[model samples]
Target: MLVNKNRSSAGFALPTVIVASVVAMMLLLVAASASTAIREGLYAQHYRRLAREAAESGVVLASKCLELNNDLAQWSNSAKLRPNTDCKGAVVAGRTQYIQQDGNVRTTFEVGEPERREGSIQRITAVGRTELIRTTDGAVWKSYEYRLAGQAGLSTLLDSVSFGYATGGGFAMSGAFFTVIDEFGRPRSAGFNGFGQLGVGSTTDTLTLKQFNIPANKRAVRTYTNFLSHGRNMFALTENGEVWGAGLNNHGQIGNPGQSVAWVTNPVQFALPSTDNVATFVAPLGIVTFVVTSQGNVYAAGLNEKGVAGINSTAATIKTPTRVPFPEKIRADAHSWALDSQTAYAIGESGAVYGWGNNEFGQLAQGDINERRAPVRLGDFGKPGKTKAVQLAFDGDTVYIRDSAGAVYSAGKTNYGQAGVPTFRLRAGVSNRCLAAVGASLRTENCSSTAANQKWHLDRTNNALQVESNPGASQNRCVEATGHNGEETRMRWCAWWSGGKRFDFRYPTNSWSYVYLSNSTDIGGRGLCIIEANSATGDTKMDSCEYYTHKVYAPYNPTLEQVASSGVVDITTDQYFATMVYANGEVKTFGLNNGALGNGVYVDTSNFDTYKRQAYNPTPVKFILPPGVKAVSSWTTSNGVDSKNGNTFVVTSDGRVFGAGSNVTGQLGIGHIGGGTNGIYPTPQQMLVLGAQGNLASYVRSGYGTTVVYANNRKVFTVGNNSNGQLGDDTTTTNPTPRANKNTNPQRHVKFY
Candidate 1:
């Protein structure tokens, strides 16, 4: 019995030990599973953070690309993306991927169509996806996707058309549309689409503007239009300084070689002298075209009848653009061309105006009827002691020239009084009306030529003119009218007169001989003049003058102020503030100030920097060329004082550039800020670009706080504020120092293609 009991105990102990070992193994398995789960959770959190960062970086990169290549047409093309090894190119349409630190992290980005809304707002969408390592299973990976939508900086170019003398019968209308460069540097158009001048790839017209179909990476800077009789031709300049043309190719006015006389519906790039950049272009009416280069040279193409092309040749039709030999370098700042039916005129940099082609009606202002094949110096106004012709305008058979003094002089046919010195006097060969002081009614009677009532004299006053009766008599009194009513004339003491004693005169028509006399103190506030009630010898009375039709020639002396206030001055006189007279008898400035006086600032002489110590000038001072600046190439200024932050930029001969006024955003291109100031360059400073040959700059343009310039080597450089990536440097990150909000200097722009 004892042996059997001992065997049972041994068996029981063996079974209990096996059960404990099984429980221990179960506990070990549970601990291992918990540790693996914790490790995976940590890995996922880290990768998620990295993926988010990668996505944000991709967004910035994509935005840079869009800013450079504003054309949405080819945005989906991989070649247009311009991706490098760092970005790994686009994986799909409008998408680009990047691998960071070898294979550790991968990020991809996709861009969506841009939506332009009213009021200059453009919305853009971007999506970014990142792939991250998650588990040892290698096949299983973690993916993080991010989306961003933001406002894009865009600029819109609006269509504009200007007619020359539309109301005066010199009407010339252009069915041409303009190409505008948006803020992103893309070309957009609106307006007359006849002959595909709008550049929308079709001849269909559009009242609403649309974008152009062109290379996705190209940016246009300037556009030109030539209104022909049947169709209008257009020209565009790219940011790379390349020239392109579209529309009517008839007569080779489009500048394209070997092109048929067919209309071009889209822009076609053309080549000129590859080394020279086009500075200015003009397409006057007819089949002629002119182009000015940065090198101070002028070129012409197309019809050459009467040698209107200025090529010094009588070729009936010139097929391509050829250089026109000028006597002197053409001023890039003020150089321009004006065309009439049979003649052409050009202005040189030295303030010399030249004329070519027909001079039948003295349209060339050369004093005689002589046509020339080459440019001839205009002798009428370009002489010493006279104002230079800064700008010119044509009115059919007449040519109107505006001098630096803002005075307008016309030459050509005068059959309808279209050209001549303005004259204001009584109508000749008509019975004169005589007025005398007789009660409240100013009665007018047929005059005896020698009577005192008919022989009146004018006297000048502080702000008006006084008509004196019987100046030869001892008691000469002031002659006054009652006003618009047919009231009798009365004599008053000149010193004690109340209101009607003073009179003002103005011209009511384009005719130089028409004049209207308005009473200053008249109760009815109407012009007073003699009106015939019946026959030529019948009773006459002072009555309301029909301003639009009534006119009289009175040899009344006047002052400069009177002429300006007469409201009869031409448009040029009304626009310019100061006139600049050149030594060569050429008036280079037409007293008009567009806020771009180019004399450093916009303020009058009284507000000049040295005004407190020097005499104040009532007119704008002449814009003295800098020491080395022989001539002005091009100039631009901020809109006006209303802009608040105004600035000026001037490109000069010899490829030098200068800036004045506000430099808050480094728009001056001087590369540094003023001491203790926000970089406001009140005076002119030479602009400099680092790493450029001779530090020379060729072309320049400016906005609120941004400045763009082209180097002599064909490279583009930018300076100033870049908060909106306007600098085109592939980054929105701004300079940390200086103003803390701007670059405070210039940087080279990245290549878009």
Candidate 2:
């Protein structure tokens, strides 16, 4: 390159000037390209960040909407444009800001609909926009937009609520006793055959809301008393402390105090002082009598099968209230009553639950399945410790009791896992003496393991346990041991006790401890649970559940009358009642019986007065979670693989979320069953996917079971039962095999595990 320096006195030649200008232009072009690349990178970063923020903002917005409306109605329809409505056009508690650091750039967020399902916040969508900060006219104005959406599912997958009907047609205080609707859109009272629970004190069933007297003041003036079921009959305690018995009293669940077989029609007086003349005795008085006929004391009456009358060794049936024993030294805390065939239990105030009569399934909790004649102490606490009991509930043979500390304990016949523990008892190390201990000891431990076939043997009889040709096996297939018989033909699978011996088998339909049944005709509503007490929003805490079911049909007739035809109209719609539980120690009943828990309540009934039209409904007390739990869910199974490496979550009964719902294999330790179109549940329960430890799961879709869940732990687990390669395992051997496929990779299998 040669410089054309001019020979002229003052300046260089025009050519030289032109060359210098060209070089300068080239440098400018290079610098501009570099600057453009940096700017583009910055823009991309901002866009991603804004998108995430927008999605989070949408969730906050949706929560605010639900707070005000209790249902998804707020997010269901579009709202008119307003300045402060955020992206969803709803006012939220949090503030959102759009920032622009670069020159001449703009960003905005747009909101979309909210999808609520299965007691969960399924999805929320939002958009963020930004405009160019600099204009063509040399002005600065940034322009950009981003859209984000969020889907918040339930914390757990286990069905916490369960419900069932008592029998005897119609809503009755004594008969049937369906959990009916109340004015507040919750299940406050049970429908009785008579006005006992109806409050009219009549035998006629009130089919219309008008038939029942609606007090001018609709506040729940009466707290939930006690509800007892025995021998096909149901007994209820009122806020005024009065006792009402209905149904059959063949066992004397509703008899008078100190007497045997003395039955009352409706709410009857329990033990008042007895006098020969009896001129001072009062009837239909608002007196609280714990004893049926004994005045001012705890008494027993009716049939005394085995000296259960508490009459100090009396074996005869008393027709009147008989003085038993009501310890006055300690305040009679809370109490609960349940019956299994001819036996019953009365959990008392001092935190002591007692039992008598039948001993089937060991419901008496006396470490033995023997019927008692009198009330025998079951245990100090529902479990082993001194933790005070918060509440006690009974469902058939299962008794559920939660302590003030929020630990749930259950015992009795866990045929359906209502007892909340593994029902199988391993009989590995057994001898004649060991069998004796097994019969006496209430606790047991698992101390045996076998890589291949193991056999059952008596340690005393032989030095070596004999392995049947194929111990724990059938013909040619291998199986895992299920805590069933130790000695078998080929040890390939285990058998868990299904109530007792001779009932151990592997069948999917009956695999689950608690099976889902039909919706309750007595207690009708969606599922719900009680999360807190003294809630400012209302007297209780609740959540709602959605179920996939056939279209519901309205009741066509009530007592042979087409009530809808008359002006005294009754509306019939088929929707499950949302669950809600009151602070007054009352559990509202609702929805399907198998999955309803928490403070789950009922919403609708065949009786007109049984239905509440409010947008928000109440239910009975669902499953009580561990306290301090903001959220409750079942994200894992009993397998060790689901230890919540930030995959699963468990909420304390107090409504706090402890961990995330991460999948370890297909199982999550957070305690939910599973998630899929066919696997997803309305209530929170524990998940039992089989695979190695660590979060690993993949689902096909909501219900279809396309997307499979392969665990990240070198094992594959499938939700919705992938019988083929969808589960990613080499073998298609385990159809509905609730075990991990160790041969497959775990990362590829993705699910909401």
lDDT of each: 0.47, 0.32
lDDT of 1: 0.47
Estimate, for each residue in 317-431, the C-alpha lDDT of model 1 and write its tens digit. Answer: 6667788888776754322556645677777766567777776545565544457788887654456676665675553344555556655554543321223322211221133
For each candidate in turn, the TM-score is 0.41, 0.34
Best by TM-score: 1
Model 1: lDDT of residue 229: 26
Off by over 4 Å in 2: 1-165, 168-202, 209-252, 257-268, 274-297, 303-316, 326-350, 380-386, 404-408, 423-753
Clashes found in each candidate (C-alpha, N, C closer than 3 A): 29, 183
User: Per-residue lDDT of 1-753 in model 2, one digit per residue for the tens?
Assistant: 987765696667889999999999999999999899999989678766765554455555554554344334443346621224643466555544443335555444555566553333345565555555545684535444455555543221111110112222222433222222222211222223332433344544432221122232221212222222221333333323444443334444445553233233343433334441111111110111224322223555555655555554555655565555544211232334433234545555556556556554455655544456666665565455675544444443445445554444444433222233322122211210100011111111221222112212211111111222242234222221122221111122223222111111111121222111111111224322111122222121122212211111011000110101111110100012112222322222222222222222222212212222211121223344433233322221111111121122232223222221223223222333334212322233343442224444321111112112333332333332232222324433223323443222211210121
